[model samples]
Target: MTLSSMSETGTCTDIINLRYQDGSVGSPSKPQKFNYQDFGQLKQTYLRKGRLFVDSTFPPDYKSLGNLSDLPRSVRSRVEWLRPSDILKAQNVKGEPSFFVESASRFDFAQGKVGNCWFLAAIASLTFQKDLMVQVVPTEQDFEDYAGIFHFRFWRFGKWVDVVIDDYLPTFQRELLSVSAKTRNEFWVPLLEKAYAKVCGSYSDMNAGLPSEAFKDFSGGVHMTYKLKEVHDRNHDEVLWGQLTRATKCKSMICSGTAQKGDTIVNTVADSGIVDAHAYSITAVAEVHDGSSNVRLVRVMNPWGEKEWNGKWSDESSWWNRVSSEDKAKCVKRDDGEFWMELEDFCQHFQILTICCENPNFIDGDVITQWKVMIYDGEWVAGRTAGGSLSNSTFSTNPQFRITVTEIDTEEKEDKNVLLSLMQIPSQRYRNDERLRPIGITVFETPAGRIENSFFRRNSPMKRIQLYGYERDLIEQHSLKPGEYVVVPSIMKAYAPGKFVLSVYTKTETSIEPHHEGEDDDDDEDHLILPTPPKPVVPAEKSSVYDIFKSYADQNGELSAWQLRKLLNETIAKGSSDLFDWSACRTMISVVDADRMGRMTFKEFSTLWSKFEDFKKIFNRSNVSKTGTLTYDELKSAVQAADIELDDNMVWLQYSLLQGDSSISLVDFLTLMLRMDNMAKKFKDKSSDGFITMDWNEFAADFMFI
Candidate 1:
């Protein structure tokens, strides 16, 4: 689809356009659709129908796949296609499989052979608070129902998605292959893990990732990472303790990991029982007595279920002797893979600590300041480009977001907080390096009216942060005044393809929306020709192509995109049979029709035609590779041959128009040449007044048809 058609409305399309046919967006304030079949509703429907829930996504196909007893662990290990009921029929208790045994807890999640201890540690932390786990793995479906289908909801990006899978799971030697529960009866852990794997493409994709990412997905919370060395060096233990205490009070999911020395495995077990470069779930942040003084302590849980921290605050440490009996009962429990360590010791050993703080008033329903979240999915490709950060002289080529903060949080003493997060899709399968793209986001304050073109980069930023490596997802918190702003997310390197979800969390009444699709800024709409003043006659020196275009021109020297479509159909097919067609005509018009006026003046048409001829000359010179066209890599030389300098955004737009193709055709090259001229002229007109600006009406006319 053309850029104009994608963004013509300048806002979210109707339910039909959004494909939200069955339900609303599901915001906290939006009306809850009683008929919507989420995990709970679907289970209740099956229960009322007196039938079991059989997930079609993954079905019981034991007879076709061979008996589970005969299947090898490596057989079809790549595909997660076995029902828990088929294999665990003997292990199951009475009926079907239970998603949870009694209630889900830290003891429920155990790390299997897969090196996804980070994920398991996050899961263990998830079980510390009932409200948090329920929000994650909703306790809606039960094993007694005998339904083979089980579903779990995860806070994906900003919305909750119900991922349904049959009780089938990946296994090695018929045992769970990935993350599993400590007990076979408690299937929520493995089932949830399989569903997540399904969402992430396959079980292998989850082999390695940051636990903070899992925490963010599970809790729908904002996560931030603090370096342990920085905290200790700064002597901010009390400050860190306060932050942890507040997070704990709000029921946040927290995890810490030790740093690696050299290339050693982070999960290496140490002689003292503390694993190096390993992830541990922080169970509690409390103060306990240590002989003469009240020592601050933080409790941690190991997913291995045995490697206890034999430190000063270990389960049998002499420090426990100073603790009062009542305090000991509340803090220490049996050897459930949990131990309390001095906060000082915990900080000294761990290198990084991450906390996924729940949105304000989410758990207790204290609606003093309601928080609403929105998510947008976007991507970048090699030939298809997204912009870099705003700090660069170049405007960002990535997806753009326009957010208007109409109301700021005034009740709290601190300034209003806007939580912006970008989570990159895991790229482990493709890269041996295993490190994901280093990513970050920048927000700038723009005019309140229509969005100016990306080339209009004069707008000053409200806040900007540098890029960070993929050890964690990119996150930023901004406290700002209520106004209009734009957010751009990009990788440190340009033109790298990375799929990501951009999530924005703010107080209710604030709105955030995607401004561009990293291709073109033109809003999508039907071809609507606006009335313009009569154009002067075109110079006679123009090529015969002008005469061909004149056949569809009006008395006012105007011709519509439809007219251009007819001309292209009649002329292009006669020469290069596969070169241009009705579809190409639409793209051609989308390029030159910058104002989206649909029709071009005779002067405008002549200018575009001459530019097209010039592009042919440049393309002919740049085809030294003997290819008929120039690949995106060779585009700079082609532009140099044409004696033009395309701005950052225009260059990105041209490559995006190529749509992942390595090369650009004669017609596509000409389209880019003319679009750049049109945008440059408009931008020049706006900048002539010292600042590039747009009023509501001007913006609507320039970008949106509305």
Candidate 2:
């Protein structure tokens, strides 16, 4: 799909287009149903039944543990699944065993046996933003009314899905086995982890990941990551420090991870007391006045609840004596896994820094700039839209979006105005079942018209945004000129089907539309061209159509798409030497496949075949020049003659898609009509009150086969 945009003068507008291939724009709306499970009804049922809720969706069996062979024999044998109530009893709680000891904070939990420090680090950062934390871990949840069920919401793709799970957590030797709290009775840590694990497919699925992945899931916000080593090497410490200060002021979630030294294993403590390959949250950034000068300091917290940094500005270091009493009071020294380190030492030890926020105002420290965001939900169907990278001939088939940047940002010296983010949505329910494809986006400067295969073949891309690795998300900032540009996102290989969410954040007002084929450039009434009346089919031709249908009809007097294909190839299509393939036949059946049984009765087949004959007559009559193709205006007439009512935009979209050079071939025109009819019928059948709702799998099943 391709999108085209135009500039409009007004306050910043945020548009969210969801769940449709048509390039319609609108604001975001709530999904009528939640993914996986519904929380409210489930909880109420359990409460009314007077029984604890045991999630059959994610049971306490070994399946939920995911591959027990990866676990140590002793730990695997001793592992026991226990609910919060049972665990509290084992701990001998005096009073009520609360879900949380107090308001959730960074110090509330410690890392467990799972190698998900990346996730824990994001959680640790999440603790600082109360609003986001509440969104992820709803505060109303508690053990008092708990029905042995807990629910947490995480941003999945473009929506927030409530993930519900039983409170049953994996334990060993009567001790909490996952993310334990600092206080003995608090259970939020493990419960939250369990819910996330369920979302990832199983506990093992959450074993290792990037903090940015968890950060995006936690807040569904803009993510920005910096390589500390690169920043230090470029002598951009001040630039990075500025970003950190602004990020902290913006209340963005921040996290960093230490580099793994040569031949060193993860979590291994080095001489400086920093753990390798471990994630840590940046709690604070300060410029403390040390008697002689001001020292840039960063507060880092290890999720382990220990292993404090022993370098300069550490709790035990003599560097603290140089700071003023007021500064020292502000920066407390403790052995509780958190320590302040000099900015230089911090950069030297940490390899990556990630910050996430709902808005990206923190970048460039431009607090007043309100960016307009446009989000689109799209998919790459294997044979249809998944047209791989630039190297492939089918590259033009990839989804294309048009962005028209009407104005430039004068506030910034640089022309950088747009931020493009392409995130692939997982088709599977679990992490282990899905593989991240190497995806990238290509932006092309084109003429003010529909982009086609010829355009791509003739022109090189203006810019190619390549993600360094096969990552789930790719983000890039660009300084595009004020004009119409088409953005194409694709996997490195063709025919790899997947869904994706594309977000465009721009400083200036811009219109974004999916540059679908057959869409018309003009909708003006004066410029509209209606198709000529079709030449009447001879009585003999009409009689022969019925004769062919009767021959293909089975004992039940019904013909499947396959049978219809044979009938057409042997009859009307035989004269023109044009043969319909299985795909075209399937589409033809879907046009009248009311029962969706892939078969059509005589009545349905007669109606479809008559329309086909009428369309063929109109196709020939419209081709007055006898060029063996129909111009855009001629195609519109043929469509109308066949009683396919399409608005100017829809007509243009279809015309653009099938047109070669400046016109559509007879084969392409017929295929377009079949597709339009099939799509229209499917839409009417599936839509309810003008809306169609489907999960990823449902959408794939309904649309992919045809």
TM-score of each: 0.60, 0.70
Off by over 4 Å in 1: 1-97, 170-180, 264-266, 331-333, 360-370, 377-385, 391-400, 403-416, 424-436, 448-460, 463-472, 491-500, 507-706
Relative to the true structure, candidate 2 has a C-alpha RMSD (angstroms) of: 16.6
Q: What is the lDDT of residue 454 in candidate 2?
A: 83
**Model 2 spans with C-alpha error above 4 angstroms:** 1-35, 68-70, 262-265, 464-468, 520-706
Q: Least accurate stretch of 10 residues (summed lDDT) in model 2?
A: 1-10
lDDT (Cα, tens digit) per residue for candidate 1, span 212-302:
8788777666677889879978998877876676566555677888876678565677877788777888877677665677788888888
RMSD of each: 15.7, 16.6
RMSD of 1: 15.7
- Candidate 2 TM-score, C-alpha based: 0.70
Error of 2 at 188 (Å): 1.8
| Cα-based lDDT at residue 91, candidate 1 | 44
